[model samples]
Target: MLCLRSRTQDAWLQRAIGATRDILVDHAHCERKAATQALMLLGRFPDVTALVEPLLDLAREELEHFELVLALLQRRGWTMESLAPSGYQAQLHALCRKAMPGKLVDLLLVAALIEARSCERFKLLAEHHPDAELRDAFGGLLAAEARHHAVFVRLAGRFDDAEAVRVRLDDLASAEVAILESMPPLSRIHA
Candidate 1:
């Protein structure tokens, strides 16, 4: 099993099922951001064997997911709106370490945590959502997100001490959950 230390709340899932248009819009932003992050990592560590090919593939898949989500929003007559700031991401990012190879390890751990949270949230929606279509759609994404999370975890091992990565991951994940608790109980993909 994945070693993520956080799980989304039940109330959050209930809120998300009702506000799918908003969630889809946020999901699109998430996909775009994921792709951008992957590319940025690629640029920063172009020669890291563990990151190069996987990050490239992640970028491609995330971009595709963005397009798919945007299309879904359009089909629902919901125009892609201006992006909003994500307190969740902001808080998690603030926890990243600021040193060399350590910085890279932190980044990978953060990515893994985010993907793990996404997978958890999607799994919740798949099981509890009232709409069959929404359930099916999110269910389809569960495997992909799980794989992304796993890949990031595996990549973090390229560091001097994978144990240290896990320690920081646990710390950041605890921080992330605290941040989530402070957020509004709204229907959002990341909420």
Candidate 2:
């Protein structure tokens, strides 16, 4: 019985590690996407050059993180796989309006929420995972995600009408919750 329990625990840990790896890959992809999106937005709104520089720096950092995650995967003899489309992102994208100011505000709020959730999940995984290396990686990722969240929040604040932003954030949060709750079992974010 002891041996069986030990095997079970080991299996669980392995699965957790695999899940974490996949999440890291997905996160790297998100960073790349965000960087590109920010650049495009900056180009469209040239007047926001000051706001764009920070985002450009963030993109570069995210790409570097992607490289790190790729190296880690290679070291572990794990091949990165294509991830299924995430409902969380889709839900956020849906909130973005077609117009200028509204579009920018919505994007910032959605980005902030995504970063916030990523930070929260990284903390949870770091605490719960059995592997020391993975735990440490998650810990570092948690800090980065927190910083990313702060950046988005700061960017969002630059816009006019604090109350309007707050209301939109609330709406996005509600939609995010629904997306998480409604996802199928294959979605590991529910874990």
Candidate 3:
């Protein structure tokens, strides 16, 4: 089940529409970072053989998305900018526990939550954004993000007990919901 809270405020949409270039810049960097994160995980957990193939696939897809987003920005005459800090993601990481025992579970839960939230945001934009191209692009990404979310959770089970991971996933999801609600709304993607 999708677990992210919708961006209930109309203001967020208005912001996104009014500042397409800025938002696209952030979105592009987000895709780049997502790929990097996947690669980093594969590097960090070489012993966890189960993570290799899926993480590599994830990294490739995310990099592909980065390129697509970059092209979209270029078509609009927008150049990529230095990424602004993502407070929302930072808050999520702060919630992550160190790997003493639950490290793998926590990391996987965070990955799942991020992908789930991104999927929700894409669906929202696909349905509501006025720009046809963007709407279609976002719609196209839905399936991939859903797959990414599932991959992370499934990998988590391989790392630990499935039932325990499920419980932790639920708890982390609730924490994510709170973080989303409390953060100041921004025009950036996933904010």
TM-scores of the models, in the order given:
0.93, 0.81, 0.93
Which candidate leads the pack in lDDT? Answer: 3
Candidate 1 lDDT tens digits, 1-191: 66656667667876887788888888888889999999989888877877888898998988888888787788778988876686788777777778978888888888888888888888998899887876787898889899999898888877858678778778877876788778887567776
Of the candidates numbered 1 and 2, which has the greater TM-score value? 1
After superposing candidate 3, which stretches have Cα over 4 Å from the reference? Answer: 5-9
**Looking at candidate 1, what is the lDDT of residue 68?**
81
Q: In candidate 3, how many clashes are counted?
A: 1
Candidates in order have lDDT scores of: 0.82, 0.67, 0.83
Q: Assess candidate 2 and give its lDDT.
A: 0.67
> Model 1, residue 21: what's the lDDT?
87
| Candidate 3 minimal-lDDT segment of 10 residues | 1-10
Number of clashes in every candidate structure? 0, 0, 1
The predictions' CA RMSDs to the true structure, in order, are: 1.5, 7.9, 1.6
Off by over 4 Å in 1: none
